[model samples]
Every structure is written in structure tokens, then in C-alpha cells.
Target: MWVERYGPKNIKDMVGNEETRISFLNWLKDWKKGSKPAILIGPPGTGKTTLVHLAADELGYNLIELNASDVRTKDKMTQKLGPTLSTHSLFNGKSLIFLDEVDGMYYRQDRGGIEFVQELIDSGRVPLVMAANIEDDKKVIKLIRKSKVFRFRRVVPRLVELYIEDILKKDVAKLSKESIRLIVREAKGDMRAAINTAQSLAGLSTEELSSVVSSRNLAYSLKESFEAFFNADSQEEAYKALIASKVPPRDKVKIAYLSVINSGLKGDTLIKALEKIGEADKIVNMIGTTQEWRLLRYLDRLLAYSLFNTLPKGSVSYSEEDMPWNLKVRMWNEGKVLKDIGGRLSKFLHISSREAVSIFMPYLLVVIGKEKKSLERFIRLLGLGESALKVMVKESERVFLKVR
Candidate 1:
């Protein structure tokens, strides 16, 4: 990928956020035992992770990096990080502990993970650094209180364009000035995305470029697409909006369902809107189950004309969905956890993982949370850590209340 191929090699080579980069380097240079850990927070594709890796190289520190995928149970964290906190490197060099995406720690599955890291930061021998996409997350807020926080803002479009231009020059590739402008504008300050788009357009003819640009420029985020669909003035406009959206058809239907239910559309309108959304959802599921992709074209009309037509007229309004970065990260992590839970339950029940997850896991969690003894027994049998157990208990409680 261009993102990796053209990634910055050193601190000075990075683009934008020059002040924040200097702050990061200064923090590293002035590091001492028990100095507050420096946490770099920003949006993805903005070079936060790259800066840390570059700074570690430039400052001659041996870096021990951990990302969100690392199991962060208390025991696992202690076992992996304890020695790093207490001892110098074997080569007699400084060691830096860099935790990337610290915002992914779900309170249930990462119980005590943050606290343990905090303890290490307070009195550890090695200098520590962390990175997360969002600063306002509750876990990140807790991290900020004990750390020197440096925020990496999005790289402005001009800087991103310059970086792309330099790369294009090196590749001996060419694009129309208009194409470059379109790519930079559509990238919305994401340097990695801008570079990737430029790379993909490297060899296309100018005539072909406009169509690609138009399609890409029309790629609204899930939230933006839903907003456009709800606020569109005509059926044709709504249909065009849905067709332009980059979200998959299945997820598009879900977004429509959530938007309508949350929009406070009531009585007959609510019933009609739900009926149309349900029909679209069924078509999406059928396509998934049968591998019949040809059915996808109908989804646009169904969602746009059939479903959106039920909206009450004259300024339908609803709050934007609160799909924060941390929440999306948490949902992904939860899916992985659920898959693991399903695998374990499948073996015990002599069923498939999908069956265990879709059929058995919900009820199992409810039963486990309701009966303390069952919870303990299952934890021991599954070798679940405190974090996983907490997740199970919380999910179980939710299921219990819904059923009741």
C-alpha cells in the first residue's frame, strides 16, 4: 500500500503537525525515570504512530511497541511489560514503551489494563509513550490526566497535496491538476488516503479520471449518507444519495433503520417506514445468504423511494448518531471476543461457532450473569480473565433486561 511505501522514515521527514512533533521529540530528549508518559492523540492516517517510531529511532531508544490487538488482561500486561519497566536494555540503551491505540481498551475486556499502565508510568524506570485516535474518550481522558498529552491535528490539504506531488514526481507519474485537486479535496486532510488515491490514479487517462473522481467524491461516510437521505428534497435526490454512498448495501439498510427509529417519526409513518426498511433488510440478507449480488441494485430504490417516502414532511430532524471512534473500535473488539466465546461454546455444545454465537451465547450469558456460581464455573472452564468475565457479565445483564 502507498501508505506504507511512502511513510515517513524520520521525525524531520514527517509532514504537518511540526509543533506537535517537536514537542514529542523534546519530551523524549528530556525523559527521566518517573517522568510523565507522553500520549500522542489524533485521528488515524495523521502520522501520530509514524512520529513515535521515527522519534524512537532518532533518539537511540530501544522501542517496545504494543498495539490494541495485544491481550491486555492484568496478568498478560504485567508479564509482558513488567521487565521493561524495571530493567535497562540488554545492550545498555534506553528503552521506550510505546502503546498504540490505547483508546481501544473496552472497560469490560481491558479491566485494570489502564490502571496497571498508569502505575508503571508513575514510577517506572523506562520512558513511556502512547498513541490514540481520540482525546475525548473516557479511557483516553484518564490517560491524559497522568501524561503529557500532545495532540496531532489532521494534516491540512495543502500539505497533503505537496506530499502527494513529491511522491508523484519520484514515481515519474502524472495527473491533471484538476485530478490532484479533487483527490486532495476528497481526502479531507487524511494524508494516507490522499496518497493511496493518487497511487491508484497514477496511470489512468485524464478522460477516465473524471468519472473515478466523481465516484470517489460522492463517497459519503455512513453518517453523512444517512443525513443526506433523510434531508433530500426529492425521490431522485434521495436515490442518488444512497447510490453515491460507499457503505455496503447490507449496512446501508441498517443505517436507514437506525435513522428512522431514532428520527421520532411516529404512528402511520413509523409503521410504513419500518415496513419498507425491513423489506430492504430482507433483500440484503438474501443477497448475503445466496451470494446473489445482482439483487443489490434494488436496495437503492427501496431505501430511497420506498422507505424515505414515509418521512413526515417539512424539516424532519434528528441528532447525528454518536458513532465515535472509540465506540467503533470497541465494537470491532467485541466482535472478536464474541467469536472467541462462540468457539468455546461450540466445542462444549457440539455445534458450530455461528450457531453458538447467534443461538446460544445470548441466553448463556443471561444465565451466567444471573447465577454467580455459573459465571465462576464458566470463567474457570473457559480460562477467561477478569476483563472477559466482566464483558460477559455486562452483556448478559443487557440480554436479561431485554428479555424481561
Candidate 2:
């Protein structure tokens, strides 16, 4: 894969998040027994794990990396790591314990997983580092508060483009500026995805790009699959495009929704298109919850039908990098607050957390902001703390700004 083939050779070779990278390096350099563990929180392909490996190599610490999600139980994790955590010496080479995707450990399934990790941090024997792609989970928030949390923003598109260009140049691969732009835009700050897509298209010509559906690797790329679906001349072609896609059914629904919303369609057209997409999404979710794998057969046809004639050809493009990095940071910082609100609202209204955030929170915040009594009542009812109230106030302000 291009990802491994073009992997950073050293810490300096890594692109973007320069400040965080330096801070992380310094943390490793200065690490000692009893030093606080560090956690890297960010989206995928943002160099969190890669930074750890590179730092371990350059700093000469024996690297012991594990996926927390894979070690399902507290007992198992302890069995695997307890010995290392308790033993260290100058005679023995220094060791770094890196737990990747710590946030992915589900407490319900992996009982006391975070608690064991907490205990390891207290041991303070090894230089510990953890990374997570999400910050909103309650256990993850607990870890964040205890550890030295370093926030990583998504890599800017220009950097990703430049990096891809460098890789292509080194490999003697030729790609048009238009093709490169499409890959970068579709990659949406994921360097791994960008490189993988570039590798898939390395030798293809511009004419081949249009008919890339005939090629399985090209069809497997989510961006190309979406493009093929949107531009297909007939319903069968659109359905075939969806079938050829390697993207999961649930993700297909989500990408389709984002693509439609960002496509600049308006009035009834947009409304009707979203309605169909929503229908598909509901079915997808139902199939997941019920574990009715047979229902998946209808998914491609449904998605193809959802957008068919919904817009003129190529009007609805893929939209992955819609949110700005600054806004993304604000969202991450307030993630726990949002999760709290969603949890409370979901229980009170008997809706899912997703619905609580997407459907209720905005309007609820607006109403409470305008009416002091309602705000008081809601805070009391939801048991919302100052942090949640602060989030509510900020979100209400956003609503008002948009309204104005």
C-alpha cells in the first residue's frame, strides 16, 4: 500500500500539526518515572500513531504498542501489560507503552478497561502514550482530564496535496492536476486515504478516469463510487455503481446525505432528496439493529433510487471536509457537554443520542436561551452542569447568528 510505501522516514518528515508534534516529542524526551501519561486526540490519518512510532524509534525507547479495543477485558489487558508496567531499569532499555484507539474500548463489553489503564498510569513505570479518534465518550473524557491531552487538527488540504505530489514524483507516477485535486478534496484531511487513492490511479489516463468503474480498485474508492453513482446515465448503472463500492451501507447513506446537502440544490428538490436519503438511512439502521443481513440486498437499489433524478448530473458532489478545523476543535472541546445533553435528552424523550443532538438540541437551546425560566427548568431537569450550560449558551448564540 502507498501508505506504508510512503511512510514518514523520521519525525521531521511528518506533515502538519507542527506544534503538537514538537510538544509530543518533548514529552517523550523528558519522560521519566511518575511523569503523567500523554494522550493524542484527533481524527484518523492525522499522524497520532505514526508520531508515536517515529518518536520511539528516534528516541531509542523500546516501543510496545497495542490497540485497546482489541484487548477486550480488564483482566486480559492486565495479563498482557502488567509485567511491563511494573518492571523498568536503566540496565534495561527504556520502554514506551502506546495504547492506540483507547477511546474505542467499550466499558460495557470491556469491563474496567479504563480503570486498569488508570491504574497503569499511576504506576508511572513506563513512558505511556494513548491515542483516540473520538473524545466524546464518557470514559475517554475521564482519561483526557487525567492525562496531558494534545489536540491534533486535521491536515490541511494543501499539505495533503503537496505530500501526495511528492510521493507521485518519487514513484514517477503521472496524474493530472484535476485528478489530484479530486483525490485531495475527497480525502478530506486523511493522508492515508489520499495516498491509497493516488496509488490506485497511478498509471490510469484521464479517459480511464471517467470509466474507472470498470476497474475494481477505482470503483472501491468511495469518492469514485459516489461520482459514478451521481453521473450514471441510468438507474441500473447507478445501482451497479453503488454495488461496486467498498464503502459500507451505513456510510453510503451518510455520504449521500452530506453530498446532497452540500450540492447546492434548493427548495423542494433538496427537501425531497433528503427525504429519500433519510428513508434509506432508517432502513440501513434497522438492518443493523435487527442483524437482518438479507435486507442489505435492497440497500444499493434504495440509495440509487434515492438520488436518481434528484438532481441534474454532477450537481451533488461528495462533501467530506465540510467543517473547518477551528470549528472541529470547538466541537471536540464541547464533545462531553454535547454527549451529556444528548444522553439526558435521549432518556427524557425516548430518542437516540444521535437524534437528541441532531433534532432536539438546537431548537431546545434556542428556546431555553430566549426564556430564562425554561433555561432554569431545563438545567434542573437534565441535571446539566455549568459545562453543559456553557455549551448550550454557545450553541444558542450560533443559532441566533445564523438566523440573523
Candidate 3:
């Protein structure tokens, strides 16, 4: 993999977070018994682990690294580090004890683990360095109170671009400026991910590039995924974030539409973003109606390339609270009504309920709008409830006017 093959070899070779790196190096160099342990906190792929590895190499300290998340219980942690707490290596050399993924350690799962670490710190037996993807965890908080904390920010875009350009120069790959921008923007300041993405795109044609970018193996939490999608600088960047997310396609579309509406976007930007989303919705509906799943491939491009220029960067963020409580309740009630109407129509028209909603409902509403008496006739024939009929009427008028 390019990430491994092209990984930074030394402290100076690493990108971004210069001051923190320097401070960490100084702490390692000035190490003594009774000194405070240090914690490196930042997002993933920002060189937290890499820094420690390089420091160990440069300083001649044998690194004894443990993943705190994996070493769940205190017993496991003790067994791993007990002998080496203040001792030399098998070679009788000094050692550095590094605990990584500290944020992933949970009190319940890693019972007594954080306390054991505290004990280690108080003992002040050896120089210790810890790394975490976030600092908000309770276990991490306990460590922070006693440790000197260093923060690492995401690598800047220009540095990432320069890094990749040098790599391409050596590898003799000829990717376009546009394709390189896609990889860089999509990486979102993750140096490791940037290298991996560039490796994936190194030899692909333009037609095949979209698939590679869309299918890139990125796993983000729902909130993270939505934020990345909405905050994307280009439509392609947003779409890549969307498709790369593990979110289900239907939920992805719903969230994308909801985010666009609530994002506070204005004027032509709002209109264009919504227009692209609407096109995506139509494509989603078409796939639902035809059961031709292959059409799903087009959604990424339709959303990304089409809306890239209009949706402002950092204009949208994902929050459950972004949606008003009243609107949510109304949507829930309306969904039940729509389900009832779809169910009745499914049986009446000998079609699936999904088809009834995705393909037939708009036309049915248009028909009822044109001929008022048809509403009563159809309601009786389909056994539609009064509440269902009211919803149907309201939806029909909305659909009718939209068509006009």
C-alpha cells in the first residue's frame, strides 16, 4: 500500500502539526523519572502513531506499544507493561511505553485500565507517550488531568497537495489536476487517506475514476458522514463522501435533502443544491420503480458534479436538533397516512406498496386533482380511511401544482 510504502521516515518528514511535534520531541529528549507523561490527541491519520514511532527510532528508545482499546482489562495491560514499566529491554536498553487509541478504552470494558495507567504515571518509572483520536472520553479525561496534552490539527490542503505531487513525480503517474483535487479534497486533511486515495487513482481512466472515488473504503459515523457531505467544497467531493458512507442509500437521500433544506443556503446556491438533490431523488425513485439496481451507480455523479459549484463549503452541518420537533412530528403523521394510502393502492392496482408510492402516487394525485369525483369513487373502492383521503387530497394538490 502507498501509505506504508510512502510513510514519513523521520520527524521532519512528517506533515503538519510542527509545533506539537517539536514540543513532543523536547519532552522525549528531556525525559527523566518523576516527569509528567504526555498525551497526543487528534483525529485519525494525522500522524499521532507515526510521531511516536519516529521519535523512538531517532531517540534510540525501544518502543513498547500497546493499543489501549485492544488491551481491554487492567490485567491485560499489566501483563503487557508490568516488567517494562521502569526496566530496560532484553538488550538492556531504555524503553518508551506507548499506549495508543486511549480514547477507545471504555471503563466498563477496560475495567481498572485507566486507574492502572494513573498508577503508572504516579510511579513515574519511565517516559510514557499516549495517543488518542479524541480527548472527550472519560478515560481520556482522567489521563489528561495528570498528563501534558499536545493537540494535532489536520494537515493543510497545500501541504497534502505538495506531498502527493512529489509522490506522483517519483511514480511517474499522470493524473489530471481535476482528479488530484478530488482525491485531496476527499481526503479532508488525512495524510494516510490522501496517499491511499492517490494510489487508487494512479492509473485509472476518467470514466473509471468516479467508481474508484465513490467506492473508496471510508467509514464515518452518521454525523461525520453527513457533515463531510454537506461541507464538501465541490459537488463531486460531497457525492464521494455520501457514497463512501455506510449509510443506506434511501436514508442518504433523505438526510441529504433535509440537510440542504435546513442548511440556511440562500438564493441561487440553495436552488442549485436543491435542484441537484431533486434530480438525485428522481433517480432514486426510478431505481425503486424499475428494480434496476445498476442505476444506483449514477447517484454519486448526479449529486456531486451537479451541485458542487453551488453548495458553499462549511455551510451545512448535521445535527438531529437541526430539524424542528414540530416538523418531525408532522412528518411522522404524514408518513403513516402515506403508508396507508400506498397500502390500499398496492392491493387495488396489483402493484407493490413501494411502486404505489414511488411510481404511481404522483399520477394518481394528478388524476384526482383533474376530476374531483374520482377521489370519492377511488376512496370507496380502495377502502381508504377518511384520514388517508385527507392526506391524499393534500398531497395531490402539492404534486399537481409542482407539475404545473
| Top TM-score hit | 2
Clashes of 3: 3
Off by over 4 Å in 3: 89-92, 203-207, 210-404
User: Candidate 1 on 77-193: residue-level lDDT in tens?
Assistant: 888877765556454668888888999977678888878777877775788888999888998998898889999888998998899888888788888787898888878788888
- Candidates in order have lDDT scores of 0.81, 0.83, 0.81
Candidate 2 residue-wise lDDT, 68-144, digit = tens: 54765789878877667656663576888889999888878888887888888887888889999989988789888
Colliding residue pairs in candidate 2: none
Top model number, lDDT: 2
Q: Per-residue lDDT of 1-404 in model 3, one digit per residue for the tens?
A: 88887888889888899999999999999998789999999988889999999999999998988885475578998888877863543546778989898887778888898888888889877888889988878778888989999999999998888888888887888787766877788788999999998998886787798666555535565677778776776666677776676766677677777777776777988888888878888889989999999878877666667765566677876755547556778888989988887887888789999799889989878867566578877777888768777777788788988998
lDDT of 3 at 82: 79
After superposing candidate 2, which stretches have Cα over 4 Å from the reference?
90-92, 203-206, 213-404
Candidate 2 minimal-lDDT segment of 10 residues: 210-219
The positional error of residue 75 in candidate 3, measured at the CA in angstroms, is 2.2
